[model samples]
Target: MISYNIFTLTNGLRVIHIPNNSDVAYCGFAVDAGTRDESENQEGMAHFVEHMIFKGTEKRHAWHILNRMERVGGELNAYTNKEETVVYSSFLKEDFERAAELLTDIVFHSTFPQQEIEKEVEVILDEIQSYKDDPSELIFDDFEELLFPSHPLGKNILGKPELLRKFKSNNAKEFTSKLYRTTNMIFFVQGNIDIKKVKRVIGKLTNDIPLLPTYKIRCKPLPYLPIKKILSKETHQAHIMIGSRGYDAYNDKRTGLYLLNNMLGGPGMNSRLNVSLREKRGLVYNVEANLTSYTDTGVFCIYFGCDIHDIDRCISITEKELKKLRDNKLSSSQLDAAKKQIIGQIGVASDNFENNALDISKSFLHYNKVEQPESIFKRIELLNSETLLDVANEMFSEDYLSTLIYK
Candidate 1:
């Protein structure tokens, strides 16, 4: 039973509160600005701006902010994604207002100092280097590039090093001023607390924040290129990712796709991609299919890692397994197993306070509704073999497929 309330401030900020029946709470501050908002030269500005928010606020220095938060044993962190940026805190219910003040101050009154900008730029440069050193992360970047091509969405969230070099303190402030507005942000707080009080506090902090300008995100349509696989010779085991476009977050068939993804390659062990390829043939190490949904678009991807010499055979087997899924419906027994797996996962996630908080936040942020666990379970339970088949056809359709291999 997740009950919540939403309040819209005069400044245009939308504050949401979900009070749980537990002692601990999770608070999340999400902005609707992310990588998609970056200009061509400012690729990754949203993510860079995220790092700057913690540098200093009007009253609190970076170290002071952490010290104060830690004194109360509160957990504070922030992240930037393709469509949003978020600063989050988790603490006992007693520390909620304190945590909120610190978070709001950092987000609203950051004083992007020149020295701090230079220092954080180098830090972000190191972070980019770290990602480059890891083949798994690097190759995913490659896959996204191939999927989106010239679009800003195709660009890495960690803007290119050359572009980072061009970023000055003024640019950081400009980006922040333009994107981090009351209209562009959504605040979410969940725990055992008074929703009315939370709303009042948020309303005070955001009273003067202005609306964001109307800017259209331009993502030109990219045609499905030919299925070409590139092998990198420097790696040990072969890492592969195949993908194509899929539906936005609100698609009705999303629940069906969830079940179909399980049947294909999901959960811990009882999945077709793992069962057939790893258990029976003993050919591959691990394989899974996953989907990423956004506001305007989405992507469905299948990834696997195997021995370099077995790459061809791995690809053949993977394609065979996927084609089999598209060609045949799940058996009644298989359908039942997938439903049980989904229901069990939902139950486990909801039983805990923190997990349930995140689940509700994800619902409000992505799907715009707090879908009940039982409702989702009912959808999974009632869906049959035919629904799974239809989902498979929609997701695994061959019109726009791509594969990228890192040796």
Candidate 2:
């Protein structure tokens, strides 16, 4: 069992403290803004800003910011996804205060220098080119593009290099000022932390933060439409991704779908798809299924890479598994084993301190409360075969699936 304390500052910052006996501390902030918030013109600003913030800040130069943690045998990093941007770090418990102050500095006081912007733009352009060169990496974005036509959600997180060149330091400042609000952010820490001390240190760091009111530009919810396209690419193996929009994170049906996805093609080699496709016949080098859930929407997907000639046969096997899931219910023993497998998997994942903090922060950002891992297990326990069958049949139907292939 994990124990955590939740508090909100007067400036509207939500902080979560999970005390542990370990000497290393993991801490970070999650801003409820990302590529989804970017306007068409601002395609990559959210991600760009994430990189820029670390380059320099008002109180610290880029050197100081990078070395602040490393000097103490620590690490600092951040990432941007479609819906959130996170800045996090790991350090010895003794450097907790230093880590906290350094994080606060970068988040609130970044100075996006012109020189840094020019250099970073080149780096980003190279990134875009590299991403384009890898069909395995590029097809996921292409599949989403096919599914969501003319929508912000469909745009690549890494905007085109031409548009990225137009970004200046002022653009970074304006974008951060608009979206990085106290009300729109949460802080999470897991380590040998003193809750009161953390509150005081972070309180002092956030003292300068104005109680900025929140803003959200709600994108019109996208309607799911299945479209299939095959692209001829210069590649060693044919890559395919098939999927459709799925249940939102808040949907009651998601728990069943979660379990259903795990039973179908989750990470473990024992998954149904692996058993049916890889172990049984040895058709592909890699095959897996995944589901990405957002606040108001979600995506259910399966991805695989195989020989060009084997593409049709592998897809047929995949469809057969889907049909079995859609048309029939798992037997009593199979259902029990699936439940145990997913429950144990969730339990093991919760042991990851960094993932726990990040996940809890997002949960609070979305639900206004943290749903304990135990709560998830209970929900999974209540999921009967009937419930799973309903989810598989509805979410896995052939009509909603979209396929993208690179050959």
Best candidate, lDDT-wise? 2
lDDT of each candidate versus the true structure: 0.78, 0.88
Identify the runs in model 1 with alpha carbons over 4 angstroms from their true place.
211-220
Question: Per-residue lDDT of 65-142 in model 2, one digit per residue for the tens?
Answer: 899999889999899988999999999998888988989889989999888889998988898999999888898888
TM-score of 2: 0.98
Q: Which clashing pairs does model 2 show?
A: none
The residue-by-residue lDDT of candidate 1 on 1-407, one tens digit each, is 56788777777777778876667777867877788888888897888888988888879788887776789888888888788788888888888888888888888888877788889999999999999888777877778778778876677999889898788878888877877777666788888889877977777766666665635455654664636568665887788987776677778777787777766788668677798779988878778888777766677778888888888887787788778878988788777777888788767767777666665666676555688776877777888788777777766766567889988
In angstroms, what RMSD does candidate 1 have relative to the true structure?
A: 2.0
What are the TM-scores, per candidate, against the unseen true structure?
Answer: 0.94, 0.98
lDDT of 2: 0.88
